[model samples]
Target chain A: MSEVYAARRERLRERCAASGSATALVSRPANVRYLAGAAPRGAVLLLGRGTDLMVCAGPLGAHPDDDRPDEALRIQTLPGAADGRGDPAVAAADLAVADGAESLAVEEHHLTVARHRAIRSVTPRLRLTDLGGAVEQLRVIKDEEEISCLRIGAEIADQALSELLESILVGRTERHLALELERRLVDHGADGPAFATSVGTGPNSGRRGHRPTDRRVEEGDFLSVCLGATYRGYRCEIGRTFVIGTSPADWQIELYDLVFAAQRAGREALIPGAEYRDVDRAARQVLDSAGYGHGLSPLTGHGVGLEIDEDPQLAPAAMGKLDTCVPVTVEPGVHLPGRGGVRIDDTLVVRPEADGGPELLTITTKELLAL
Target chain B: MSEVYAARRERLRERCAASGSATALVSRPANVRYLAGAAPRGAVLLLGRGTDLMVCAGPLGAHPDDDRPDEALRIQTLPGAADGRGDPAVAAADLAVADGAESLAVEEHHLTVARHRAIRSVTPRLRLTDLGGAVEQLRVIKDEEEISCLRIGAEIADQALSELLESILVGRTERHLALELERRLVDHGADGPAFATSVGTGPNSGRRGHRPTDRRVEEGDFLSVCLGATYRGYRCEIGRTFVIGTSPADWQIELYDLVFAAQRAGREALIPGAEYRDVDRAARQVLDSAGYGHGLSPLTGHGVGLEIDEDPQLAPAAMGKLDTCVPVTVEPGVHLPGRGGVRIDDTLVVRPEADGGPELLTITTKELLAL
Candidate 1:
């Protein structure tokens, strides 16, 4: 694991050196974790031009039970960070200057303008440059270990969703169900829910990123839930819609089938070399032709890994192409104003045709179920 | 409530006008919520030089059940935010330019360098100026309505903590305890947790911001838990320490008593004109006299409002004086290297001596209980 993290840091160093920066700072939590194996809250990774270091705001190994920062890197702690006055990024910049680095690259998208100015003031002689999304691009293709973590996370999410299906859901509010699913995820060995669990009932169903409300599930209503689990820091998502009662209304069944088909098309299009927008189109065109395109969500799905949402976005106007081992989600849905809606989503890894195509990580049955 | 939000926005506008800016953009979610009533996720508030607007990425009234964006303010939605493609800040900047504003003030501490640059590029002729902590400073003093919400949030948090104390704890893990506490917070009608619940046992006990783990309660363990509830967006925090078994060891009792005294001293120092550092010193000196000050957290207490941690931080180096109606948490703790430790935290509001001194929002008993 340490070697893997070291290799990642080495690659980042090469990118920085090529861009005329011998050293780089990673303040984004996910980016720091990707190169440092683990990052304590408020920790930053200062890479190259010195001993690779993970500078933490608090004590080293704050969560020692699960924290396993790369053994190959040294750790430094700011004296008063836990009190909220210390900033690891500024301290890391000072360290960069002490290491004799002439220039340092940083993630301009992550650091606030105030922090950037402070860093500049702390190390006025050290030239600062934008590292852009270099680390994010490097993370697009996952190693086998990373994929295994995502696979486990997906399995946990599937177990949690399936268990919710077997239980009595009617009369229970969306907020309660969301909380139950989160507890189940943890019981199944997940670090936590990858994101806030969304359980929408009736009119609220099928809305993307819908925050769970107190509206209780009722008979003849559509219930949509989107949840994920984080296993070993890898996140995977699965969303499904179901009928509240035994028999679904005609409109509910129709909407569910349409969303299911669209989601399937998006998943099936997750082949290596496929353009991101093409995959989005595969799912989007299904809904567009069906006349439900007016309020369709922006993207069919998005890449999921260390962060629930990542690069290789399967959206219209997206420029990137998918690659093998890149895990992404395929979610598509539509909602009627006063009625309900349906959303079917799954996590899958892009794979070559020789490897039997995209590997589905979340195997929860998407068939519209009447519970 | 709408009038309250309108007045807050007017005050911010006056500040911006005095700073040579005709308009201001608030991107920080809490600050936006403070000025715009209820801001949607990824929403920004554009104030002055035109009609006050809350520019959101999603649909209008996404969470109509509880969302109450100021009725006096206009709501605008970016067409592609739910698809994860829209940036409310950039759109707000464009609106500022369209409003004929020659200069705009933005929260530089919250906006990323990339985003700040994007806003600059979008409206090059519109001079961008730093709003700094103008909004945060405005938020330090609470109105009667704001204090009422915080009072309710503190009550909910206290109920949750007391309920947990009555449950069987010998075999429970810290993670389970944390989850149960959060569930209770929601059950009691909280919007959600103010922050991540922290439950630490044995060697992990009393560490500020300790992430829960799977360690089960042991007979002689010192168990510490810190949790908060969010009621209508007002956040309040409470923390307590207990011995897992029927009787505590001498060291556990001593440490618990010391922390309790420290917390009490800090809480008692919350006067209308008290210097922030004086409150911190009132707590720090107790721990320092007992030789436990070496690793004490930087700030003994800090102001709380829409955001859990806010301005007027009660720290040694914090520059400010406490004003009446400013709610803050006085949390003091000690983390022993190998054994365990103790922390006692409570939320209180500063008041004049004529008004019965400080108002204790969290009335949970600070006694060290043996569960």
Candidate 2:
């Protein structure tokens, strides 16, 4: 495990050196956690000229969840950072200059302008360069170990959703149901919900990222739920739409079938070397041809990993190809204002056609069940 | 309500004019919400030459929680922003240039370097100035309505904590307890938990902002829980520690008593016009004199409002004076590594001596109850 982190840092260092930077500062929490085994709050990883250092505001040991740094790497705690005076990134840049590094690469997208200015003021001679999304790019493809975490997270989410299906959902407020799903996820051994559990009912159904409200579940209404779980830092997402009555309305059935077919098309497009946009179009065209494309969500799906949302977005304008071992969600939905809609989503890993194709991690049936 | 937002924007406009920036762009969500009465995701407020405008990625009405913009303000949605191509801040800057504003002020502390650069590239002639923490300063003193929201949120938190005290808790894990508390808060009509609820047991007890873990309660362990609720966009915090068994160990009783005294002193120091550092010192001195100051947390407390952690942090090096109606938490805790510790926190509003002193919002007793 320690060697895995060290190898990742070495890869980042080689990339920085290739880009003419002798040092790279990783302040983004996820990126820091990727290079170093752990990322304590306000902690930054500085790949210096001679050695890599994890600069933290306080002792990392105090945080139980933050993974300890690889023994090969050094840890430095600023004297007053615990009192909020010290910034780990600035301290890392100062260390980079002290180590005789001429150029430092930082994630300009993550660090605020003021923090960047502070870094420049502290090291006037050191040239600052943009690290950009190099770490995020590296995180796109996952090893089997990473996939295992996602699989477990998906299982936890599936279990939670299954339990919710068995309970009496009618008359329950969207807020309570969402909370119950989250609790069940934790009960089934998840760190927490990957993101907020979205439970949209009635007119709120099929809305992407809809926050749970006090609206109660009612007969003949569309009930859509989108939730995920985080297990050991890896996140997986799953969404399904169901009917709340004994028999669904004609529009509800039609919308559910259309969304299910679209989601299936999107999921089936998850082959290695497929263009991200093509995969999105596979699902999008189904909905577009059905005349529900005007207010469709931006993307059919997106890559997921340590972060709930990551790289390789499946959208019309997205510029990337799916690779083997990349985990992504294939969610497609259509919502009509004042009426409900449907969305079916799943997390799967891309694989070569010869190898059994995509491995579906979230296996909850999307049959539009009527309770 | 709309007039209040317009008045807040007017005050910001006056400040920007005084600072020589003809136009101000507010991108920080809380500041935008404060000035515009709504802050949809990826939205930026531009106090343009002609009128203040909110630029968002999607229709603001689609989001249920986002407050409607003041009727006097205009709203513009970029064509491709919903699909992730457009950035509201950059578009606002471009609009500022088009509106004939020679100079623009932005929240440099909130904007990323890449974003600031993009804004500059799009509007090369516009002189970009730092808005600094001007909006945050304006938000430091809450109006009566804002204070009322915090008061209600505190009452909800107290209700949730009281309910938890009556439940069986001999062997429950920290995570379950935290989740239960959050569910209860929502049951009591909170929009949601202000922040992640913290529940630490035994050795994990009394750590500030400690993430709940799988550790279960034991016979003589110290249990500490910290939670808050957000009501109508206002947030408040409360924390308390209790003994697990019928009788606490001699050391546990002594430590709990000392922490209670320190917390009481901190609460007593929340009078109007008090220096922020003095409030922190009042709490620190109690624990410091008892030889437990070596590993104390950075700050004694901090202000809470729209965001859980906001302005007016009460720390040793903090420079500010508390004003009337400023809601803050005086949370002082001591963690003794393997032995566990105690923390007592409450949200209170500062008031003049003539007005009967500070108003305590979280009314849960400080007494150490053996559950």
Candidate 3:
């Protein structure tokens, strides 16, 4: 694990050196964790001329549940412990300047304007440059260990969803169902829900990011649930839409079939070199030709890893192509105003046709189940 | 309720006008919610020259659990549906400049350097000024309506804790306990958990922000739990320490008593006009004099409102005077290296001595109970 983190840092160092920066400062927690084995809250990773240090805001004492900092890197916790005073990013910049590093690269997108100004104030002579999404791009293709974590996370999500289906859920409220699913996810050894568990029922079903509510599951309403689990630091998402009662209405069946087919098309388009926009179009064109394009969400799918939403966005305006090991979600949905709607989502890793095509992480039945 | 949001916006307008800016842009979600009644994710509130518009990346769709936006205010979903392309703050600034406003005040601390540069690039003639923590200062002394929400949230938290106490807890993991508490919080009408629930057992106990893990309870172990509930957007927190066995060891009792005394002293110091450092010292000095100061947490308490952790931080270095109606959490804990320790926390509102001193929002029992 330590070697893996060190190798990741070395790769980031190469990117920084290519950009004329001798030091790289990672302040984003996920980025820091990606480069450093583990990042304590408020920890910043400074890869400088002297030594790599993970600067933290609080005491370095261990908490039972905390991910221990990699022993290969030095750990530094600041004094005074006041908020906004002892920023780790500034500490990193100062350390780099003291170590005689001429140029430092920082994630300008992650650090706030005030923090950026503070870093400049601390190291007046050190040249500051943007690292941009270099760390994010480096994280796009997962190593085997990273993929294993995502795989476990997806399995945990599946188990939680499966258990929810076996229970009597007709009279339960969306909030209760969501909470129960989250509890089951943890019971199945997940770190926690990858994001807030969303259970949308009735008129609220199929809406993207729809929060759970008190509305009870009715006999003829659409029931859509989107949930995920975090294993280690990796996250995977899965969404499914079902109908209430023993039989689905004609509209419900059509909407469910359309979304399921669209989501399947999006997942199938996940080739090693496919353009991101092409995958989005594969999913979106199906909905568009079906006259459900105007109110569609901006993107059909997105990359999921340490954060529920990451790079390699499958959107019409998105640039870049899917890499072989890139894991992304292919979620497509259509919501009809007061009548509810349908959404089908799955997490899959892009693979070449020679390697048996896209590898599906979340294996849950997407058939229109009238429960 | 709409009138309250309108009045809050009016106050901000007055401040901007006095500072020579005709309009203000609020980008922080909590700040937006403070002035616009409810904040949608990625929503920005613009106090235009002639009118106020709440700009969002998408339509003002309802969340399943969270509160809906106050319908009185005008809303504008951006022309393009893509999130990366639309900048509500910049759009608000452009609207102000187009409406013949010469200057715009924006939350500099909240806005990123890139976003600031982009706004400047688009509206070259418009003078941009910093609105540093002005809205936060305005939020310090909450109104009676806000207090009522906190009070209800506190009740929900109290109910959740009480229910947990009645359940069997000899062998449950910390993660399961935390999840159960959160489920109960929702069962009692919380919008959600105020923050991630913290449950620590044995060696993990008494740590601030301890992420719950798979540590099962054992006899003679110290168990510390910190939890809260958010009602309507107002958040209140409460933490308590307990002994797992029938009777606590002599050391556990002594530690719990010392921490309780320190917490009580801190609560007594929360009078209107009390110095923030003095309140922290009132809590700190007790633990310091008792020879348990080396591993104390950085702060004693902090203000809680629309956000769980907000302004008016009560720390040794914090410079501010507490005012009436300011809600804060005084959480003081001692974490021993090898053995677990104790932490006691509560949410209280600062009030005048004549008004019966500090009003406790979270009325959970602080007694050292041996479960």
* TM values, all candidates: 0.98, 0.99, 0.98
Docking level for model 2: medium
Between candidates 2 and 3, the TM-score winner: 2
Give one digit per residue, the lDDT tens place, for model 2 in B49-86.
57889998877656455467777889898986777797
Off by over 4 Å in 3: B62-66
Runs with alpha carbons beyond 4 Å of true place in candidate 2: A63-66, B63-66
Looking at every candidate separately, what fraction of the true A–B Cα contacts under 8 Å does it contain?
Answer: 0.86, 0.82, 0.63
- Candidate closest to the true structure, highest DockQ: 2
Q: What TM-score does chain B of candidate 1 reach?
A: 0.97
Please give, as one word, the docking class of candidate 3: medium
Tens-digit lDDT string for candidate 2 (A38-119): 7788999999767789999987766556467777889998886887797999999999988888889999999999999999
Better of 2 and 3 by lDDT: 2
| Comparison by DockQ, 1 against 2, better one | 2
Clashes in model 3: which pairs? none
Lowest lDDT block of 10, candidate 1 chain B: B59-68
What is candidate 3's lDDT per residue for B1-371, written digit by digit as tens?
Answer: 88898888889888888878778889989999999888887888888667888888767775434556677778888866564777887787787787888888888778877788889999999988888787998999999999999999999999999999999998999999999999999999998999999998998899888889898988999999999999988899999999998889898999999999999999999989899999999999999999998878778999999999998888888998999999999999988877888999999999888889999988888988889
lDDT of 1 by residue, B228-331 (tens): 99988999999989998887899988888899899889988888888999999999999999999798888998889999999878999888889999999999
lDDT of 1 by residue, A11-59 (tens): 9999888888999999999999999988788899999776999898887
Q: Write the per-residue lDDT of candidate 3 for residues A65-141, one digit (tens) a residue.
A: 57887889998888864455788889878888778888888887778777888888888898888888899999999
